[model samples]
Target: MVTLIIATIPACELALSDVFASLPDIEIEAERIVKGEENAAMPLLWVRGVEPDDFEAACEADPTIDDLELLADFDEELLYRMQWFDRIGLLFQMLTNANATILEAVGESETWHLRLLYPSREHLSKTKTFCSEHGLSFSIDAIRNMDRDPSGRYGLTSIQYNALITAVDAGYFDVPREVTLDELAAEMNLSHQALSECLRRGTHVLIEDTVLIGAAEFNL
Candidate 1:
């Protein structure tokens, strides 16, 4: 189970729900197996290209924009290599191949951050060195060092699940806005106490299915 989180925490959190929902919902028959347990291995590696100006233009352009294909292709290659190790988790990289053909088109000059998830530290380390040797000048941000909250159980009862969906729809629990529990309950037309238990359960499912297993299946 591995996932990569780039961007700020709040932005990452918002992106999580959106990203997970985009994945097909069909269930797989595999059981959850904790890999690299007790080894304190980091599962993610972030790589960012130095061409800041070009990276921003790529982000703003449509995904189908022809000019951005090269940068997108490079990112796909990184993802491909990571998956080859069976240790690859998630990847987010910044590059210089987008619609900003002119320098003036680059606004605010945003930096790109990519988070790559690997199955083990060994795999991550090897990939890191590979990038550095290639003159990529990328940095590594290990997952083990990040503060991942021990998520409480979420996704239990159907009512609770609905409440979570309601919150998500309203963007209530969004960390950026800090949706209050009371407010979420009201929005769901349920009592706050009842909603709280449901939220706890729903969160657990989200963490397990989306955060852990989602990254494990990439570019496959």
Candidate 2:
């Protein structure tokens, strides 16, 4: 599920055959695809390209690529068959690996938008085609800003606090069913290690402030 973006001219009719021809070793298998706005000159592309390098050189040659660019060198294969829980875990990784400017929305199936500073039509076409073949949809919308303030009162780190707030905002924490730490971590876009630390610190504070204070308040 590694994503590599390449910017090309023209909004439609991407000559993918030429792009695939460049990387013959890595099979250009189709997967979930998506594209940018229909009217835009160049759209964003996300594809499961071949191993090692996908289109870094093309990005370099094309100055239209944005600073929060998707590098085509990393590996993201396990994402294909991951279960719902595993998918959540990977989602956290995706958020972490993504640039700080990553934009997220919860209105419909958790949409993420990375503002495209540089546009590429060829890459967008191929990636959209690939996603279509794999039954994934793509959209082009403005990136939304997170509502949580970073300098909050909690001891939780900025990301941890943001994650908790995001979950609370999304109503994930309000679910009645049992919530796994892994799942929470995944939902928060944090590693298990970080998630565990936050919980530990939170539990300690609760015991000191709430649990202890409650005994005195209620005479329990």
RMSD of each: 17.1, 18.9
Q: Please provide TM-scores, in order, for all candidate models, with all chains considered together.
A: 0.27, 0.22
Worst 10 residues of 1 by lDDT: 98-107
Residue 149, model 2: lDDT of 45
The residue-by-residue lDDT of candidate 1 on 184-218, one tens digit each, is 77766778888887777567656643454322212
Q: Give candidate 2 misplaced runs (Cα > 4 Å).
A: 1-151, 170-172, 178-180, 206-220
Task: Give the residue spans of candidate 1 off by over 4 A.
Answer: 1-157, 175-179, 214-220
**CA displacement after TM-score superposition, residue 5 of candidate 2 (Å):** 50
Report backbone clashes per prediction. Answer: 13, 7
- Looking at candidate 1, what is the lDDT of residue 120? 42
Please write out the lDDT profile of model 2 over residues 2-74, one tens digit for every residue: 1222122111122233334454432222122222233112223344444433444433333223232343434
lDDT for residue 122 in candidate 2, whole number 0-100: 41
